[model samples]
Target: MTTSSNSSLSDVEPSKTPKNILLLAIGSMGDVLPFVNLGVGFRRHGHNVIIAANTRFRSFVEEKGFAFREVNWDMQHEWENTDAGSPFMFDFLKQGFQKSYSNSESVLNNVDFVVLGTGAAYMYPECLFRNVPAAYVCFYPWASSKSYTGAAYGRSFDSLQWLPFQLNVKIWKTIDQVATFWSDVGLLPIYNQRLKELGLPPAERLPWLPGGAFEKNQIPVIHALNRNLIQIQKNPLNPLEIQMDYPSLNIKEELKDFVPPHDLVEFLSRGRRPIYFGYGSMHSFSDAESRVLIWLEVMSLLPQNQRALFSDVGNIKMKELDDAIKSGRVFIIDHIPHSWLFPQTCCVVHHGGSGTTHSVVRAGVPSVVVPHFADQPWWASILHRLGVAPNTGIQANAITTDKLFSALLEVLSSEEIQEKAAKIGSKIKKEQKRSPVSKIVAYIEKYWEKTKWDVLTLDDEQQKVKVKDNWRQVNGNCYGNRMMNGNDDMQDVYL
Candidate 1:
């Protein structure tokens, strides 16, 4: 448990508190929802939190009673149009960042602190130039470490585990380079242009080096994962990482006064608890019709007494499945908050987005994760490791009716898995009662306390002097120099 010198900053109290915080969250609903919960926490504590996300989330963000800024990226459109296995996913992400940078400068001008998501790391160099304290909010582990396989790659190299640590690191670095090459090419030019406009030197054209954002900016990271689900091992690579419980905004209480559709309510009452199947925003399959057909086949294999609730949130067209909807065995819904619905279900099956994974886990329901891309497979693996899902779950490409039926039957019949899930759900409920937001707020305040003195006490000339000194220190080391030259390709090594 060795600590850094900045550990003292954890105790400092700021002379001036940061009132305005801009959280730039640019991804799927899964990515944005957690931040929305965090923003609610910030607002409760008297900070004016503005969530800058895709325009599609405007109503969702505004409904939460916080200021909303619209970024140019639409996750729904990208998800529906892009293939899950496309290498262009990283390029698309980079474009989103570029668009965000162009539109968010005005919003950034007013913010006292900036919190960015994992995909928005391109903003860190600019945050450094502006001297605004910034922290990264990651839903998954982004830093390079030896404790686990890199989350970005979504697979482990078990055969390479016997290799030396340095060799493993190099292998991981090479994998990242191949994965993120297009993203780097698309993003670096735009970022360099922004730096030039700000009267700063252009940043290095670095590939997406794991943990480079926090390392380069010397800021803490608020990781939004429960330690109970995923234990945080000390990453010798990045010491400033803070693991907090998942921030869940359960909307069930708010919906208590409201009424569900009459048919849906009746369906819930008529049968034993139904199984839920929804992919949320993932459109990995070729088309909605094909997915529905496969789902129908899978549902036919279920016991006569078991009903199913199918969500048509992404590309799935519920109208096309009129026979299933009319039969009363299956109910097709546009969208329902998982927090409100998952507990009522016997089990859940879906594309394993982080939000969906956490939601079903908290609901204490067994899961059948049909992973598409990105961290979905990794999360499915976690659920399996936790005994809440079948082994390895089901990969998207390999999903057949038989495989789906087998996996679903195994979980549904396993009393051990059910009991384990219930225990995990109990733990999650206990954690939810203990507000993760308050702890995060306190940590942010401490960050301000540590840096505010220097930022406030220095005169114009002294500030320039301090900036120069800090820049020299930041760029002096071999690692720093490599980062500056875009040569540092830090990688996570797994045993």
Candidate 2:
């Protein structure tokens, strides 16, 4: 198999013992799992690893033999407690922002490095100010042009989709201003002073930076994503590439008993080819009753020959499952590891969370995505565009039994969809060439070994000079670029 340069990074020998690592993701298990894998890989290589996330997964994390720090981001409770469903979802995000800021205040100063996901990085301003070296890992390909967040966070409606880029810039500008304002209020005016010292224009208002802009401010950032897939036409500042690849549970057969619901054997034996339909962590269907009715209606339309598994884990009550059970081909399960369950499935229907999207795709199953809010729609759009699935609008509410049935048939019946899915699956397999854990570990080792804490300083003038000299030598070795090189050199000097 042909391997890319990124895959080769992990193979480099380390020159020093690795440092303790902290990974903070305050979302669902899907949001936290890949980092978990990375942490596990770190520990395996003899570094201490700690994961901070929602308490819901505390037991799961400890059971995996890792330290679990609780993040009181009550995402689920916020939804359930909200008076209005859809609009209250905005409050839900605000609540998320608050919790993330608080969590960062508590942990940023202590960690050697931090790696965060999207909603998680909303707290990044804290880490950044704390002088912590950090990485932002966007699990999915970006679609928007926002400076920090990509189109992945924007609305799916074509009209509103363009708004994130425009709005986010103003919002980030505001956040920067807020940071400057808070600096005047508190003794830590270092960041604000630095802005002034650099002779940059003062921000109009407080920057909508993650975390209250209190703390140290000297962190270097490493973005981790696939650059090609990021939206460029939509947002011009799209060169950032962060690490991709979701973490695998790597749960062995022996560990099956430790997984939830206490009915492991029965869950596994239910069927070898059950289609899975469960939104990971985030619940898109606020109208539980309508969602259940739609789910029932859609399941009824699927061919009797096809078996499926439904997890109304966050919505529909267990007692309301009379119809779901009557459909002999469908099994209603509470929870099962998607990593394990997806491969046995003929196909999947899901809320396209980045983690779930990659897991199912890695399993090589043709799937359908009925997105529910936020990034899910972006995933649905991409997967639909990729032809492995039909983008059947947002949530089951927008999809009728006819729509659902057609989508199901489209993936299951179409040999073309199956072929395309297999082709995409092969590409994903190639993409997972090297484990992210190893690459991250290698990066840490190299950076630490060379300068130790000296690398912490923002100054790299000497290194910059050496890099320029080496580039000049390399240019001299290559043919016919003296004039063009002179232009680039002049531009670099001007910049």
> Pick by TM-score: which candidate is best?
1
Q: Candidate 1: misplaced stretches above 4 Å?
A: 1-4, 8-18, 87-90, 156-190, 202-213, 236-238, 250-259, 283-286, 313-320, 453-472, 478-495
Choose the strongest candidate by lDDT: 1
Q: Give the backbone clash total of model 1.
A: 0
Displacement of the residue 114 alpha carbon in candidate 1, Å? 1.3
Q: Each candidate: how many clashes?
A: 0, 23
Q: Please list the C-alpha lDDT of all candidates, in the order they appear.
A: 0.68, 0.53
lDDT of 2 by residue, 109-222 (tens): 456666665556555445434445455555643322233323333334232344655575445333333333343244223333433433332222122222121101112123
CA RMSD of all predictions: 4.5, 10.2
Q: After superposition, how far is residue 194 of candidate 1 from its true place, in Å?
A: 3.5
RMSD of 2: 10.2
